[model samples]
Target: MKDLFCLIMAGGSGTRFWPWSRTVKPKQFFKIFNDESLIQSTISRFSTFISTENIYIVSNKSQSAVLEGQTSMLYRENLIYEPVGKNTLPCIGLAAMFAELENPEGIMVVSPSDHHIHNEKLFSETIHAAIIIALENEGIVTIGITPNSPATGYGYIQTAEDITGRNSIKQFKIKQFVENPTKSQQPVTLKREDFIGTAVYLFLKYRYFLNQ
Candidate 1:
């Protein structure tokens, strides 16, 4: 089996949460849902398939202490810090560089550190299915959530008609990405086609930015 490297992005200041989540201890470090912090839970979710050594955290230098305290179970060297917060792309690129050097042919999984997932089993299954697609193909595989309502905050992905591929996995060719569509743009009723974007994605062999 090829190596699977997990990069947990946790560089956000989390100003949205405000007073409850401060600069030193952001939302990722907060135990809002349960005893374990969000970052810890995120690590635990990946730990089911990926080893602790293969898992890495990409965060701002400011949250060093808090991040260390929360996820001390992982290798100390796995913590890659950004001098300043440059958002998701930079964080992912920086971590991807490290992962590339370690194992250029390895699969890289990029995920946020603060998502609240209710169904762990289903989430894992979806991720595994995405991984299989990535391994067999030469493109980026992202997990999509089926939308129940017309939520403006989330970006909607309109997938192409089913091509009768992957019997178990509901796979499709992405037709287009509509970011935060207005009421006028969204359909009256979301059918079997609508899906919301989840940041969680897998890169086949660390050449994520490249095309076939």
Candidate 2:
């Protein structure tokens, strides 16, 4: 698994978080729970499974200085600087290029730098499983988080019948990626077990990762 690579998406300024999370310091850098900021926690959590050198953080040029200062202990070369924010698709593409340059057959894991995973062990196991599935088969793998609440703020993922798994990481033919619904179109009630795409994707093959 030396070719295994982790792409940490840390570009967003997280305007939704408001006053506390500003442009200078986004939600990912916010210390919501522990002394460690969200981005720091993300790097620390994954470092236990993957080497610091294998982890690459994709962030905007403005946030590069802050990210560098915060993640100085980690491999500095792995920090990928994006001149602009082009959303996940383009960011993933850039990371794929970097991974391919390092190792043509590299397997890349893309994840957000702001999420809070309560179960680190489970998350790691799930990610590993997804990596295996993605490598064995030519398909995109995404980690779907079981929604804890009826979040109108998040988009929902409807899994295909063939995809089956106890954990959130399951094979799904992405039915439809729904955006956050507005108040007028909001449903009366929402379920807790509803699945939502965490934007955490796994690319098993470098070619497949780059093409997608």
Candidate 3:
């Protein structure tokens, strides 16, 4: 069987949860809602589909000691130390580059280190579906969450068409990526189908670990 790799981006400064969330220790390594930390939960989430051996963490030099102390399951070799923070695009690109070099045909699962999923069962099922979709098609498959509100905090995706079917969820041809709008700019009557939220689960065809 081909390998499934998990790349965790944990280098964020975590400004949202400031004071508690430090530069040396981001929100990903802390647990406010659960006993296990956010990053720990993320690892557990992906570990169901792939082994810890295939799991990799990409963080900056600032958090090396904190990450080492907190993440016991993560191997020293698996911790990719990025010197500088360039943002998610560069971080993901670097992970993908390393993965492709390791195993071009492998399934690469890229996700943020910090996130709270209320629906664990549904999340797992959706990931499994994404892996299957990527494997069969041998391409990139991005997972977008079903929007529950019209809050302008998150960027929205305008769907060209709704390709939903019985039992299965709908797939859309992304018409445009809309930036966050102000409170007054928001739709007065909000509906579930108004927009698609970002869960940040990116499944790309590739494969492993390289500390930068």
How does each model score on TM-score? 0.87, 0.86, 0.85
| Candidate 3 local lDDT, residue 17 | 88
Top-scoring candidate (TM-score): 1
- The window of 10 residues in a row where model 2 has the poorest summed lDDT is 185-194
User: What global local distance difference test value does model 2 have?
Assistant: 0.76
Local distance difference test, candidate 1: 0.77
Better of 1 and 3 by TM-score: 1
Candidate 2 local lDDT, 1-212, one digit each (tens) = 67888888999876879877777678998788999999999888878777787889999888877888899867877888887788888888887888788788877888889988788778778878887777778867777766545566666666656666555655566665567755553353243234454545555676786676
Which wins on TM-score, candidate 2 or candidate 3? 2
lDDT of 3 at 101: 65
Q: What is the C-alpha RMSD of each candidate to the true structure, in Å?
A: 2.5, 2.8, 3.8
Whole-model Cα lDDT per candidate?
0.77, 0.76, 0.74
Candidate 3 on 100-178: residue-level lDDT in tens? Answer: 6666767788888998888888788777777777676645666776565667766666666765433364565566666
Q: Which window of 10 residues has the lowest lDDT sum in candidate 1?
A: 188-197
Clashes of 1: 0
